[model samples]
Target: MGDELIEKAQELKTMIQNSAEYQKYDSCRHILKEDEELYRKVNEFRKKNFEFQTEGSAENGQADRLAEAYADVLGQKAVMEYMNAELILCRKLQEIYGLLVGDLEFDLDFLQ
Candidate 1:
């Protein structure tokens, strides 16, 4: 049964890879990679964003600076398009994940 589930998951992965959203995201990623400077900037922003999100801390001006940097990065048309495509792909993946796991049974009343 576990093997069957793994096989089905692989099929779902292949289907996602064939999706338009994934194609666009992949294309934009390749384009970003072609530009060294832009790729560096994007990676830096993404790292900071991820760190901030995970830390859940907004020091005096940290949040503002991050927001400003975000605006600056997204102000570029290519970056904006890439981000949009990425967001679309992520949302699709999230929806699929929710549908797959939303019905699973779990006992977690301890935290409450």
Candidate 2:
């Protein structure tokens, strides 16, 4: 049963890799990396965005700063395309995971 689950996971992984959203994201990622400076900026912005999200609340104009950084990077065509592609791919993964777990029952109100 464990081996069967692993095989099914690999098949799902392959299917995701072959998906249009993943293909576009992979292409845009390569294109984005062609510009090292832009890629660096994008990574930095991603770090800041992640921090902002995990913090759960904005403090001392952090939201504004993050927005400004986003606007700056997104003004570049490559960055905008890469970000959009990434978002689409992420949403696809989220949908897939949601479906896979939708039937599972869990109670964890303590975490909140």
Candidate 3:
């Protein structure tokens, strides 16, 4: 399941990397939509894992530890790492978009 999610992330990353729309302001809104979806999934996973931890604590410390470790590996931190990477890519694309559209005042660093 983790592998599948990672694979999906990679696929989305590739799509963004290759998209001409990702290179233009006219489609910046679309890229934001994709980012929003990714963030939504990350938040959903975090919430579900938190709920799991809350509901399963009575099982044993072993299970709780395992879940916590798994969440650490697959939850908010991992998602944030991916988002940081994507932010770099998006910044590059936004640079091109700004140059082409002549809106040089926008800052991409805020996305970080």
Looking at candidate 2, the ten consecutive residues that score lowest on lDDT are 56-65
Q: Model 2, 1-112: lDDT tens per residue?
A: 9999999999999999999999999999999999999899899988888787789656667877787857978789999899999999999999999999999989979899
Query: What's the alpha carbon RMSD for model 2?
Result: 1.8
Query: Candidate 3 local accuracy as lDDT?
Result: 0.59
Q: Native-vs-model 2 lDDT?
A: 0.89
Winning model by TM-score: 2
Question: How do the residues 9-111 of candidate 3 rate in per-residue lDDT, one tens digit apiece?
Answer: 7886687666654444324434434667655655565566566678975365755655565564445544645545556666876775566569546677979
CA lDDT, every model vs. true structure: 0.87, 0.89, 0.59
Worst lDDT window (10 residues) for model 1? 55-64
TM-score, per-candidate, Cα-based:
0.86, 0.89, 0.28
Q: TM-score: which is higher, 2 or 3?
A: 2
Report the lDDT of model 2 for residue 97.
Answer: 95
lDDT tens readout by residue for model 1, 26-108: 99999878889888898888788778777876665676788796787768878888989999999999999899999998899
Higher-ranked by lDDT: 1 or 2? 2
Error of 2 at 31 (Å): 0.3
Candidate 1 deviation (Cα RMSD) = 2.0
What's model 1's overall lDDT? 0.87
